[model samples]
Target chain A: MKSLRTFIPIIILLVAWEAAARSGLWSRIVFPSLVNIGREFFLFIVQADAWEQIWTSLYRAFGGFALAAVVGVLLGMLMGRSQLVAGLFDPLFSGTYAVPKLALFPIFIFVFGIGSLSKVALIFLECLYPMVIMTYHGARSVNRVLVWSAENMGATRGEILRRVVIPATTPYIFAAFRVAVPVAMIVVVITEMISSADGLGYLVIYSLSSLRTDRMLAMVVVIALIGYALDKLVVLARDRLIYWEKLDTYYV
Target chain B: MPHAQRLAGAGLLLVILVAWQLAALRGLPSYLLGPLEIARHFAAALGSQELYEHAVASLLRALPGFALGTLLGITLGLAAGIARSFDELLSPLVFLTYPVPKIVMLPVFMLWFGIGDLSKILIIALACFYPTFINAYYGARATPRILVWSARNMGAGEALIFRRVVLPAALPLIFAGLRVSLALSFIVMFATEMINARSGLGHLIREAENGLRFDLMYVSLVSIAILGYAGDRLLRFSRRYFLPWEESHA
Candidate 1:
């Protein structure tokens, strides 16, 4: 019954869209019928080249995201534990936090070349902020008494970090992951749209320019599904990895 | 401790600038401008009409969209937060589509609304909506249950309780969301302009790239960076005005 409620609005939207498509008040280009879009989507998905495009985008997003995750967590942990590092870095991050790193893409294209490397680098740069910021806050705010207790118990620094600090920070790390994953996807699509020979974003642009609105909409749907799935993947991982803590306050 | 720490931070920034200047002296790449070189170019451009034209164009695209999106987001979000039926009807759609890059809708919007500032503004609004809505919803949801009960016990009406208690409680999170949305508005604005615009800093950079006007590129980059930083500072400053009782996030 609860699940059924969720479908009502979506169904209404689809129905309304189909009605508009058939209403004949507008051209077919404006409102491609859903059936046509579905057929185009199916055709696109079945192609071997389509899978390669998907892989290209996925790999680039992941390459940058993985680099960011490792570097950001380590840097964040250091900042959290050491006042010198915190004082040195916090202002830099906060001050530049609102600046759109996307603006750096033109320069990146020159330095990294007009290829996957620059896009990947940009993705890494964008994703790094959330990871570092969240992890720093989490690690800094860890219950001080827990650290004191562990110290009194004669636990080594490494042991204390592993046993207490990491456990406490895992929730934050996962939260950062949730934010960064979509960010990676957003950067990938934007970069590809701006300049790329191949990728889902390029394909969408390609279809539109050719006036294949149905095919273009199909690609949009595919991108949306992939984005939705990636977000779900993060949520699933967070739930599994951080079993002790429910997802954080921001989550529904 | 605070004084020394602040000095150390300043020292680090100074060191970075000097190192970049030295690297340029040693022949940095043609594409990469030195800090001082960029500064000179930006100062020169500051005296020109071109920079102002582009800056105004970009702001025109970004600000209206930001206003429209945030206004709608706050209204709907607050409604959803307080009303269960509204939450059930609306939230699932918002969450499901939240991760989808809203930029993809640009082409569609362009086709529908025409290839003008209107499409760009609408796309920016669409991008800005999610963060504000989610933040506002959560803020409303996080209203203290006891406060609501106490208001009701004291014979406060529903409308009065919402206006006095719920709105105030939600202000901080809504502001946080606004900050996020404001940042997003710039990003989407920049991206859209880069993708297709005759004017704006993004366009200036793209034009400079194609024309190999390295100084122009740096000038545009510097301008946008300053604008972004200034906008953030302005937002933070205004938050204090609106949220006098709340602790500042900074």
Candidate 2:
């Protein structure tokens, strides 16, 4: 009964979509039938060009995310542990937090070139904010009692950080990663769509321009699946690594 | 001491700007303008109608989309939080699509709604929906059970309990969601405009990029920065006003 309830809305949506497609109220271009979209999706998955586009987008997203995770965590940890560092960098992040970093894309293109480099860099910058902010919060809020206990046990700074601080911050880091991974995907796709010769985003544009709405919808599905899977992957990793902390938030 | 620290912070930024200007004096790419030059350009543009027009266009697209998306998100999210059937029916779908970038639908939107303000507005609305929905949902769900019980015991009806208890409790998180979606609305608005638009800061920047008008590019960038910062401040202020009992903290 519980499982059935979960699928009910999805079933209704699909049925409604199919009905809309068959109702002939609009052109097929506007509402491609599920069967057509499914066929196109199948065709796309089997195509080498589609695989290449997927790989291009995936690598760009992953490259940027990996870079952000490393830098953001290190900087966040530094800021968390040191008041001076926090004082110095906190304003920099928060003040510019509202600014759309996408505004800098044109400059990035000139500096990094109109290739995967620019896309990856933009993704890195975009993903960096959430990671650093979340990790900083987590690291800063590690219980004072835990630190005091660790010190009382004659633990070194390194030992205390490794045994106590890192563990406490792990959950927050994962939380940041969860927020960031999707952002990375979003940036990659947006950048690619804005300027790129190849990638899933580019393919979507390409299909749309060619008036292949069905194929375009198929690409959308592929992009959505990749996004959904990446999110689920992060949740799985978080659960495995931070087993002690159950992610009860709807965010996951 | 706190004032001194803030000055120190500004000092660092000032130093970076100075260094950048010095570097430009030596030699830098044409695409890269010094801070002073950029500021001068921004000032010049401020005197012109072009900047205002584009900024207004951008705001028109961003604000309406934001209002619509947040309104729907808050209503549905709160409903789902209060009712079990709605929760089961809607939440899974929302969560599943939560991570999917809604920008991919822009082309489809353009196809369906025409390549006009409607498409841009709808895309922005779609992008703004997720954060607000999730935040509002969590905010309502996290309402204190004890408070609800007390209200019930006091003979308060369901509507009364919701209005007095749930709404207030959810306001903070709802504000957080609004803050996030406000940022997102600008982003999606900028992106859609950049991708394809006749006017707006994004379009202006794109034009500058293609025309190699570094001054115009910087002007547009500064305009967007100012707009975004101002909108954020406005939201923060409103949040404080609405939730007076909740302490203002970043």
Candidate 3:
């Protein structure tokens, strides 16, 4: 029953989409039939070079994300643990938090060239803020009582940070991942769409330019699947690691 | 402690600026401009009519899309939160596609809606919708049921309860969503403009890049940055004014 409930809305949307496609009111290009899209999707997956495009996008997103994770956590940990670090860095992140970092893409392209490096760098910059802010907040708000108890047991500062602070901050780090991963995907796709010869985003633009709406839709589905899979992967990891704390909140 | 912290942050910023300027003085690349040089270009641009034209165009696209998206998200999300049938019917679809980048829909939107501002506006709306919707839904759901019961016990009406109790509780999360979507609106607006547009800061920056007009690029960059910062500040101040009883922690 639960599974059925989950699929119900999806079924409705698919039905509505098919109906629209068959309505004959609009051109086939405007609303490509699902069968056509599915065929293209199948075709896309079987093509050897298509996988390369997917790989290009995946590497850019993950590479940037991984770098940001390491740097953001370290920086956040430093800020959370040391007042001086927080004082020095907080304003930099928070003040520009509202600014669209996409503005720097032009500069990044000039510096890093029109290759994947610029996209990766942009992703890193975008993902860094969320990770730092979330991790810092998580680390800052760890129970003082727990630290006091650890101290009473004669644990060193390093031990406390490793054992308690890290575990406590893990949930928040995962929350940041939830935010960052999608953002990385968004940035990669946008950057590639703006400027790239290959990648799923490039494929979307390329197909559209050639007026192959079905192929383009197929690419969209591929990007959507990869994005959805990455999110599910993060959730699965969080569940396995943070078993003690249920993710009850809808918003992080 | 707060005073010292402010001083440290400001000091670091000053150091970075000075270092950048010194680097420029030592003959940095043509593509790079010093902070002062960039400032001078921006000041000069400020005197020209082109800056305001592009700024206005950018805001026109961003603001309307933001307003439309947030309005629909809040309304639908709050409705879903209060009613189970609507929730079960819609929640799955929303959550299912939540991770998918909405920007990919731009091509399709263009094909269907025409290659104009309408499609761009719709795409921005689509991009901004998710965060606000989810946040508002959660906010409404998180409202204390006891308060609702108390309101009923005190003979308050349904609409009154909704307006007086539910909306207030949901405002914080809604505001959180608003901030996210607001930032998102600027990004999507910039992106759509960058992808294709004759006028706007995004277009200006792209044109500058292609022409190797480094100073013009910085001028557009700085303009968007200031606009983003100002929009964020305005939203924060409004939140404080409206939700005075609630601490503005987030």
Candidate 4:
């Protein structure tokens, strides 16, 4: 019953949308009926081409995300642990944090070619910032007492890092992951939308140009579901691994 | 050793640039220009009025949308976070759709708002809205409960408590959200312009690419980097000024 209360607004919105669609006030193109959209959405799931496009987008997003995860964590940890590294790389990352790396896509196209490579590269650049910055903070602020205790107990440097620093920074790593995953999705979609013949984003643009509003909406739904599911998957993983803490809120 | 390390970093950058320059010197491709040549072209373009006009156009779309979105997000999110009734009415919607790429609504927005700056601005605003709202909500919710209770016990009214206790506590996270929104505003603006636009840095880059003006492409890219960096610095400055007690998070 409590859960139902939370869904009231969503239900009302759907009802309003259906009513508006059925009223004949706007063209079907402007607001496709929910039934038509649902059918198209179902068809989209069953279609091989749609699956391929979805896979293409997923691959690009994950490719970049994985690369960022590896490189960002390493760089972040180095910066956090070494003052010299921090002084050098900190300025670079924080300085350009606000700059939209998307502006380099044209150059990337010229260098990496107008294909999945360019899109993934851009995604990697975009996702790297939050991951690195968040992880740097996490690693840098690991409790000094924990490290001292581990050393006092005759733990080696590697042992201290593996047992203490890693555990301490896990929450922040997960936080960065949450931020980077959505960023990966956004970058992939943006790049594909900007220039691509395949991927879900390209499919969206293609559907729109063909005046297939229902299909476009269905694709949008699919994109949203993918994004939401990826986020849930991250949360599930974090919950299982870092069971000591619960994610009480969404934003880091 | 510190000086040596600094030199090593700078040397690495210099080596990369020299290698690229050397590669271009050997006639790499029509699309690829040397760093020196690109820098020269960017300098030349800076003297022209076209770049300024495009930069202004891009800024007009991004800044206004960023401001509007952050303003609305902070206001609504703070209210919702503080008031249970508002939270019940709005938070579910926000949280459920939080992961959904707000950019997908660009088409629908374009249909409703027309294929002009309005739609672009609104879409950017919509994108910016999520981070700001989420951050502001969390910030307000995370306000020290002890502080609020003490204020209440001291006979502070609700409005006073909110203004004196909640807003200041929430300001840091709100600023963090603003930074994200600012970056997002630029990305969305660039995307919309790239996909379709008469003028802007994104449009400039696309035109330059299509016209085979590699210099212009680099010029637009550098201009965007400067704009983004400057905007971030400005935000950080304001954050420091307003929330002097809080340490820099970004």
Candidate 5:
């Protein structure tokens, strides 16, 4: 019953959209019919060129997200465990936390060239923050009672970290993943839209420029579906790996 | 004790800058400006009117969008949290679309709102809306039931309890949402300008890149960094001012 209630708004939105599309008071460019959009989406899915663009975007987003996951976990763990490290790096991260890293894209283009390399690097930088911050909070909040009990049983440093610290921090790592995945998609599309020869972002721009509003909307749908799918993948992995914990947050 | 730690932090930053300057002396790419050179260019730009024009243009878009989005987000989110019917009606849609990249709406917004500042501002507002709504929703729902009961026992009316009990409890998280939204506003504003605009810092950097004016590029970079950092500081200051009873950690 609750699940059915949730679908009401979505259904109403779609019906309204279809009605507006059929109204004809507005240009098709502004309100492309759902049927045309569905057809364009089908074409987009079947085309080899479209798949290549999707692959390019997926690889860039994945490459950056994977790198951030590894490095951010390590750095965040260190910062959480060591006060000295925290003092040194906390200000650095939190200080520039609100600054738009997109401002550095031009410089990155000059340094890393106008290709996947620069885009991947920027994505890596952006994803790194949430990962590090969340993981740091997670690791720092691990129960001292657990650590003391483990030490009393003669567990070594490595064992304590592996058994106690990591298990406790797993939930937060997943939270960070939830935040970073969409960010990876956002950065990839934004970078491609700003300046790129290939990727879904570039395709959206290309379609818009050539006055194919249907194709552009189709690309938008594809991008949104990919973003949603990536988020689901993260949740699935988190659920499988951390079966002991419930997904308590509304987002992840 | 804290003072010494702060000094140590400053010392570390100084070390990084000096090291960068040293590396540049050995010769780096022309595209990369050393710390001293960036400072010089920033100072020169500060003396000119051009930087202010671009900065103001960027702010005009970011501020209005941030204000509008957060205001609506907080109001609707609180309403949904406090009222079950509203929650069932609104939250499902918000959560379903939460993971989708909001920036993809830019082109469509351009088509509907026209190819002007209106589209860009609206896009930024749309992007800014999500975080604030989520945070405020959680904040309102997380309020302790005991407190609400106590307020009611004291004969406080519905509006009184809501204003007194709900608002204070939610302020911290709401501020957190605003911080995230403010940062997002700058990012979306920069992106829209970069994708299509005649003016703003993003456009200035694009022109500099095309012209190969390395100094101007660094100047724009420095200006943006300063703006972002300053905006964050201002937000933190206001948070402290408003929530004096709450202790801030990091």
Candidate 6:
């Protein structure tokens, strides 16, 4: 019941949208009816090309996200454990952290080509900073007491890392994942919208150009659902794997 | 030790650049310009008035959106955090839609606002809002309850308590949010320009790409990189000045 109350604003917005669509204040092209948008959305789901576009986007996003996760965690862990490594890489990461990596997408297209590879590479680069930074914080702050206790028990370094460090840093990893997933989606969509002939972003641009506002809104809906679903999937996986800590926010 | 480490980092960068330069010396592809060549082209571009015009266009779009978004986001987010009524009305919407990329609304914005800098600026503002709002919300909410109670006991009014206690405590997180939003504003600005624009660095790069002007492309890339890096440094310097007591993350 409480959760249902949280959706009241969204419902109200939807009603206002329907009213606006029907009020004759604007052209049908400007404000497509909700029913028309719903129908287009339904039709979109059944279409093979729509599914392919979604798949293409998902493939790039997940591919880049997965790659960033692996490399970022490793680099972060290394930096956290070794002052030398930290000194070398810390400035490099933080100095460039606020720079929009998307600015390099053009160069990436040249370097990696206009295919999925370039998009994935940009996504990976964009997602890497958050994952690395968050994991570094988490790994560096792992309680020294735990490490000491493990060592006093004659545990090997490998065992200490496995039993204490990884578990302690899991929450931060998930936090980083929460941050990176949206980034992955953003990079993929931006890249597709900028250059690609495929994917949901391209479909949005295509639909708009063709003066099918309803269809474009439908595509936006599809993209939003994918983003929301991906976020929920991350939350679900985090809850299952790192069940000890619940995420405070929807994504974080 | 610090000197050695700095030298090592610089050396690593130099090695990579030198390797690329040597590869270019052997005749690389049309697309891949050497670092030195890129630097030279960037300098040449900087000498021209066109680069300045494009840079100003990009900056105008990004900075105004960033300022507007951060201002609104910090205000609304702080209000929602403190006031139950506002929280009930606003936070649900913000949190629920947080994951959706704001860029997806660019088309709708273009339709509503017209296909000009207005739409692009608004879209960038929308993108910048989420991080600042979320961070500021959490920042304000996370303020120690004891401090608020003590302030109340001292006969401080609501406004006084908020201005003196809550805002100060929340400023760090607000700064964090602003940093994120600044980065996002640039990104959204670039993306909007790339998707549709007659001006800005994104358009310059695209034009260069289509024309096969490798030097122009490299110049644009280097220009953007320098702009991004310089913006970040300026933010850090301001943060240091404003929050002198706060131990910033390196």
TM-score of predicted chain B versus true chain B for each candidate = 0.97, 0.97, 0.98, 0.93, 0.97, 0.96
- Global fold similarity of model 3 (TM-score): 0.98
Between candidates 1 and 3, the lDDT winner? 3
Across A1-252, the per-residue lDDT of candidate 4 in tens digits comes to 878899999999999999999999999988899999999999999988888889999999999999999999999888888877876777667767888999989889988999899998999999999889988988899999989989999999899889888888878889999989988998888888889999988988889999998999998999999999999999889988997656554444
Q: Which is superior by DockQ, 4 or 5? A: 5
lDDT of each: 0.90, 0.90, 0.92, 0.89, 0.90, 0.88
Runs off by more than 4 Å, candidate 6: A246-252, B1-4
State the lDDT of candidate 6 residue by residue for B1-250, as single tens digits: 3787777667666787899999999999878888888888888888899999999999999999998998999999999989988888899999778889889999999998989999999999999898889888888998999999999999999999999899988888888888888888988988999899999988898898889898988777777777888887788789888788898664
Better of 2 and 5 by lDDT: 2
Query: Which lDDT tens digits does candidate 2 get at residues A114-218?
Result: 998988999999989988888888889999999999999999999999999999999989988988998898888899889999999999999999989999999
Better of 3 and 4 by DockQ: 3
The i-RMS of candidate 5 is: 2.1
Interface CA RMSD, all predictions = 2.1, 2.0, 1.4, 2.7, 2.1, 2.3
- In candidate 1, list every pair of residues with a backbone clash: none
Q: In DockQ terms, which candidate is top? A: 3
Better of 3 and 4 by lDDT: 3
Clashing residue pairs found in predicted model 3: none
Residue range B129-247, candidate 5, lDDT tens digits: 99889988988998999999999999999999999999999888888888888888999999998899888898898999899999998888888888889998998899999899887
Least lDDT summed over 10 consecutive residues: which range in candidate 3 chain A? Answer: A243-252
Task: For candidate 5, give the docking quality class from DockQ.
Answer: medium
**RMSD in Å for all candidates:** 1.4, 1.4, 1.2, 2.1, 1.5, 1.7
lDDT of 4 by residue, B187-228 (tens): 999999999899999999999989988888889988998898
Which stretches of model 3 miss by more than 4 angstroms?
A248-252
User: What CAPRI class is candidate 1?
Assistant: medium
Best candidate, lDDT: 3
Report chain A TM-scores, every model.
0.98, 0.97, 0.98, 0.97, 0.97, 0.97
